[model samples]
Target: MQRKNSILRSSKRGGFAMIMAIILIVVLTTIMALTLSLTSQTTKQTSDLYLREQAVLLAKSAAELALLKVSGWNRATSGCLTSVNAVYPSTTNKIFDINVTMKYIGLGCGGSADYIPAIVTPESNGTVLMDVTVTSDPGVSTEPIRYFRRTLQKL
Candidate 1:
């Protein structure tokens, strides 16, 4: 009888161990899945932030270039000053592209009211409004990232 009882107890213990093992596996799997999800989200956020910063920097550079172009304009010319509107690098990048558009305002230039706020008038010398647009494509993502920067400068 004792030997039979021992056999029954061993079987019960074996069954319990199996159940515990399954539970442990399930818990571990859940934890691992959660960890992977969090990591992916963090990586995406970091990538987006980096792209945004790059766009901002590119915008600033484009604005400076616009200013230089306007400064070099020959006032003696009869026609309106030529605005700068072009893409950077000329060659396309798979990741990002930068576009710069500059419009002249005030004095010799028209369409000042469209760009300049009603509260503020264009300077006597002149004003140049520069709009820089940066677009980035993250290959893995379905949506593309776009950043726009507008700068107003008195020439």
Candidate 2:
């Protein structure tokens, strides 16, 4: 009778051990899944930040080029200043092209606002204003990481 009781006890202990092993496996699997998900999220955020930085740099370069054109015109002693045009380099990883245009204001005393040039005029007044457009590459679905638009008038 004692031997039979010992055998029953051994079987109960084995069943308990099997249950614990199953539970441990489940817990480990869950932890691994969470870790992978976190890693993926971190990678995606890094890519977005890098792309945004590039876009800002591209835009600034375009603005500088436009300003150069304006200054160049003023330095020229003679010749009726007209419109200015400029283009910027292409961006990679779905960035955009920068375009700038400036029109010279004519007729200092033209009372009609319609007669005023579309762009800021340094000749009529000392202030020159420019319009800048940074357009994303065609068919690029990525949302612009950043967008900046301003009218700058300088003497």
Candidate number of the best lDDT:
1
Q: lDDT at 44 for candidate 2? A: 74
Candidate 1 vs. true structure, TM-score:
0.74
Candidate 1 error regions (>4 Å)? 1-8, 75-94, 110-123, 137-142
Q: How high is the lDDT of residue 91 in model 2? A: 35
**Model 2, range 1-155, lDDT digits (tens) per residue?**
45455666676898899999999999999999999999988877777677666667766666676666666754445442333333334334535666555443442322332235344644556444455666655444344444455455453
Candidate 2: where is the Cα deviation over 4 Å? 1-9, 73-94, 101-126, 131-146, 151-155
Compute the lDDT for candidate 2. Answer: 0.56
How many collisions per candidate? 0, 0
lDDT of 1 by residue, 1-155 (tens): 35455666676898899999999999999999999999999988987787777777777886788678668766567444445555434546456666666665554444432343232443434776777787765662456778888887877
Candidate 2 TM-score, C-alpha based:
0.59
Residue pairs with clashing backbones, model 2: none
